[model samples]
Target: MKKVLPFVLLLVAVVLALVFPSVEPVTVADATFDTGDTAWMLVSTALVLLMTPGLAYFYGGMVRKKNVISTMLQSLVCMGLITVLWVIFGFSLAFGEDIGGLIGNPATFFMMKGMLGNQAWPLAPTIPLVLFAMFQLKFAVITPALITGAFAERIRFNSYLIFLCLFMIVIYVPLAHATWHPEGILFQKGVLDFAGGTVVHMSAGWAALASALFLKKRTTPAHTPARVSYVILGTGLLWFGWFGFNAGSAVGAGALAATALATTTTASAAAAMAWIFFDIFRGKKPSAMGACIGAVVGLVAITPAAGFVTVPHSLVIGVVAAVISNLVVLWRTRTNIDDTLDVFPCHGVGGMVGMLLTGVFAHQNVNAGNTTGNGLFYGETKLFLTHLVALVVVSVFAFVGSYILLVITNAISPLRVSAEDEEAGLDLSQHDEEL
Candidate 1:
């Protein structure tokens, strides 16, 4: 009762404010005024902003120390490159007025047409257009960064810059519009991606797979592949930032955001346990790296469903995702594909798992007017079928599109470095410095 008193009082205040509105409602006069929703979004954007650097460290630690800086730079560089493109035309191409259900018109290039004061393209009522842009910027910053993990230790720096430019315009923008735009085919068809299971994770995962196939593997295995400390630190940062990634998707300081926060935490915890158990069963002690990776998989799995499912459902989803991703990673290594950082296993498998489970676990009670109606427990199976269709379409498009892009990139310039460069390592050969 003591703990419940504060919540009770808060609820009363909300109800009173809604019921007995003031004669003149307060308005945020400043475009950047610190309203509750705006404040939350600002913090959320910062959290997601941290993830790019965190991803750099995560991939950096996985590669040999000789190539650590080079590997990390791949992610870091995308932050700047993608942000510039996004401001120029990427946002307009993605979130501008829809054109015949295909793509957004480029009417907002350079943010020229819509001034800072314009609310025409606002994502959240309380947050300014610029704030929304910055939030989405974080998403754009991370997707290409995820791909660097796949072709790490290979791939020329010049070609990579070209690839990112092409990818942001051709791939990420279209997909973001397809899933997120108000009139998007998937969104109109009742697909329930609360965050970016399809848009970000699935797309990045498939692209990573294509990159691995095109780039080929390192000629020799890493001399010392273990960087447990760096991996652990990177994982910790990712976990912290993911709260914004999932909860911030709600776009408001409301009940939905609170629910998303709870589910995200629960799923991550469950996945961590599941990974540790799998390691124990495999006759190895679960290392900190394994546990951290498992937690990330769980978080990814629940990303699309964070605001749609109950906390208990998120736990189940996370555990299942961790187990499946762990097995997939192990199985991929047995083949010659050489997905350097297991992107296909972690993000690809986890995204697929989350998309499907979203259909099973999504409940209308959580968010009224949710298009799916009810969850499996509530006797709705149609949503599950729709999820399957979305998964297949996204997977096929991402994989095929990425493969073609890689082929084109390779044709323009050699994708991998020369044999001498490969032997000497990217840090020394490409950057002229060694970590």
Candidate 2:
């Protein structure tokens, strides 16, 4: 029954495409479209799509040689699985008409209906609705992929697939709706996630922690990273692609995009430097792995504040985030919790730091769209308090919700590998392929 189930689902999807070839037109006049914005978004969408593969390489390099293929495949498979889920109903669940401010109604865009014509998302008025959907799809793709690092080398691939779907439907979609949908609770609460500190980073980070805990320690701890060079290359790709991930939130080719781009660059640079310097201060040699991880941490930290804070303050965010995340990594290594590649420390902690700092440093003067008022540093307390509330709420929700989902997934299909399989390496045990 399980063997035929996937084929049946795909067949049903094919039937839907054949049955409803033409979706109805969306609202918004054709003249409202801006070529420049559309063009930039097209590029942005492509750039964001590149990130998943970069993540594959980034994660692949950090796992043991025996498990490298399995680790990387976990990231790459999301490109396929999440993309299918997104096109069918994942997008709707995230961006469809609000369902009581918590989730989008799946029927609103079921099978991507109502995607034709000149419609624009309410928040992104310049780009076509389809473009906005595609751009957001990239965000959805990379998110669960980020959590893969936490349970690397120990999970069952089939079980992981089930968990991935549940996580997207249960966790990522709700968070995306609550943060990005205009009617979302967080949006209504004045939660200012310029990109996805809350939606992408915080949710994924917390889930990563939950996964690491649920999976427990590997049978035999994985050894040193297979290839540091792949990490460097992946970092470069991620750095390049992040311009779109952050700036494209502007939804148009405008000054805000430029501002986001500048801040993204500066924050990543500052974080890389801070990581190396912090390592040196701790009597550890500065290494490529540290630099790459630091740069990515900076990117994660600055994601929320990219468009809301100035460049100088972005530097502050980077430096602070790098030091904090680095410390968390140190702490995690000493603990029994075996989060491979330190996803919680680097992304979860970095994201939390970014979220809090956004509340602290965001200025109304930088983006007039910020009706939330100035951050705490500028003598306002509302935004920071709101963030604190959101932080606590989201952290608990993601962690607890994910652990439940993990338990459910494990019940359906055992999550852990057999000890024999674990010793043989997941590359052969999981997929029968090797790096």
Candidate 3:
């Protein structure tokens, strides 16, 4: 019944897709469109999409050789699975007509009904609405992929898929709507998440923590990474693609984008340096993995403040985030919770630091569009306090919601591989293949 039910539902969706083709009247380039902005957005969308494959490599290299293929597939699968869901109604659920200041109406853009025209999202007026939606689709794709790092090596493939879908519906969509939707509760309260410190990183990070807690520890916890070179390559790709993730959030190829790009570069560099140096100071050899992870933490830390803070302040954000996350990683090692790859410490804590620092370093001089008053550094308490409260709320919601979803998924599909399967390795046991 379980296997048949999935096939049946997919058949229904297939029938529906064929029945409802997106044959809306297409409009060629309209006068309202700026070629530069549109061109940049097109490039930006492609760049962000590349990050998922990059993530696959990043996570794949960290697991044992037996689980390498399984781990990589988890990240790659989101590209196929989430994109279909996004095109159907996921976009509307995150960006459609406001629903009581909490969510978007799922039917607002059913099957992208009205997207073929010269329409533009209110926030991104230069590009077609469809372009904006596609850009956001990349973000949606990579988020659940981020959580994969925590539960890597032990999760059932089918159960992971179910949990991924449940996560998007219950966790990612609501947070996206609440933070990015103009009328969203958080947005209205002046939460200035320039990219996705709160939306993408924080949500994925807390969910990773929840998954680590719920899944407990692996049966064979002692293992070494399969390929450090793959991790390095993945980090390079992620760093390159992140230019689009942060700078492209400006939604235009203007000064703001340039500012974001500069800040992203500086923050990441500073973080890499800090991470390796901090390790050396601790009498540990400065390793390539440390450098790559540090760079990513920097990237995560500066995501929310990229467009809103100066380059120097971005350096501060990066260094502070790296040091803090390193400490948390050290602490996690001392505890019983095996967060497989320390997703919570690096992404979760890095995101929290970024969000709070944005409240401290953001200023109108950098981006006059900030109606939210100056940050704490400029003697404003409102912004910082608002972020503090939002941080707690987001933490609780993501952790609790993800834990519940894990329980439900376990009931349906059994979240873990069997003991024999675990011994055989997920690649051979689950996929009938081996690296």
Candidate 4:
């Protein structure tokens, strides 16, 4: 009892922090800007930033110990590489003025003209354009990083770098523009991705599937199975960062942000429970991997609906997403296709489920003007159909583009290492270091 008291007290404090209302309102008039919103976004950006490293650990622990450092480096290196690319041209191509409804112009390259003197873009107010750019930088970094997991333990470092550059230019930027920009085709068509369900998760997940197919399989089975403790720690960090990823999408410190936060938490919890229950029903003990994967599925599913769905509706979305993604992972393992880290199953399947459910559960009372006033149960099924269209289009584009890029990359240099290098492990063979 004595040993557990400290942990109990810490948990109580966290609960109070979450539930307790602030007596004083933190507003912009009280400072240089909307301090409350700025503070929240800043914190959110940092939280989202942490997820890349969390991804590193998550992917790292899944590979053989000899290749752990190399696998982890793929994610960590993207943090630096993508940040520069975003500032240089990635952001402009995604968020700048539309060009023929297909892509954004390079009007804001280097964020030169638009970022002067705390200038605000039309898309988000209260926060500076620089803050918005940095917030998005985290997303740009993680999408390609997610693909690293699919090709883990075998990809050449130089080829991986080349692949990231191509992915950012050819696949990620256009998808991000289509989903996130106000004048984007999907946005114009009324797709309701509050954060990045289609743009980030689906794009990365499908690309992961393509990469896994193109790369074939690792030459060696993992000498050391994934470490459960590392998986748990990575999951915890991802959960913490996801609050920023979802809630920050609201771009304000208001009721919408609160709604997003609530929905995010509810969905994650519900999915975790559902996954555990499913494991028990299958005659297997609940696993840390199941909990981690379930939490991620919930996060992915809610990304498009975080600000639109009610708490209870979000719970349903999470539960259903977990079941679908779990089944998809199981089905994929039965095939020869080796999605090394199940990225397609969790993110791709969860994104599709969430997108459809968002249509079913979306209510006018929540975030109004969401195409349909009432949900599917309320006799409005157009939203559901629209979601299905978005999923199919995004999936096709991602898979096809990724496949072409992989073929091009293979022509330039081998995508996978030699069998001897694979046996020695990527960390030593590619980086000249033993884990």
Instruction: Summarize candidate 3's per-residue lDDT along 1-435 as a digit string, tens digits.
Output: 767866876786687689777778655444288899999999999999999999999999999999999999999999988887888889999999999878899988777767877878888888888999999999999999999999888889988989989999999989999999999999999989998999999999999999999988999787899999999999999999999999999999999999999999999999999999999999999999999999999999999999999999999999999999999999999998889999999999999999999999999899987888899999999999999999999999999999999999999989988889988999999999989
Please report the TM-score between candidate 1 and the true structure.
0.90
Better of 2 and 4 by TM-score: 2
Off by over 4 Å in 1: 1-34, 118-123
| Consecutive 10-residue window with the lowest summed lDDT within model 1 | 20-29
RMSD of each: 11.8, 1.1, 1.5, 11.2
In model 3, the runs with Cα more than 4 Å from the true position are 26-31
Runs in model 4 lying further than 4 Å from the true structure: 1-33, 221-224, 369-373
Point to the candidate with the largest lDDT: 3
* Residue-by-residue lDDT tens digits, candidate 4, 1-435: 534643664475456445542333223332245788888889989989999999888778777787888988999999987876676668889888888656888765433334645555566777877788889889999989988878887788877877887899889889888877878898887788888888888888888999999989776543464576777888888888989999988887888989999999999999988998998888889988888889888998998889888998999999999988988988988988778888999887788788888888888788864654556856887777777788889889999999999999888767899999988878889988875
lDDT of each: 0.84, 0.92, 0.92, 0.82
**lDDT per residue as tens, model 1, 1-435:** 534643664475456546533343233444443389889999999999999888988888888877888899999998877876676568888888887665788764343234345343444656776778789889999998998888988778878877887888888888888888888778788888888888899999999999998888789744565476888888889989999999999988899999999999999999999999999999989788789889989989999999999999999999999999999998998888888889989998999999999999999888774776676767888888888998999899899999899888788767899878978889998898877
The Cα error of candidate 1 at residue 220, in Å, is 1.3
Task: Give per-residue lDDT, candidate 3, residue 308.
Answer: 94
In angstroms, how far off is 111's CA in candidate 4? 5.1
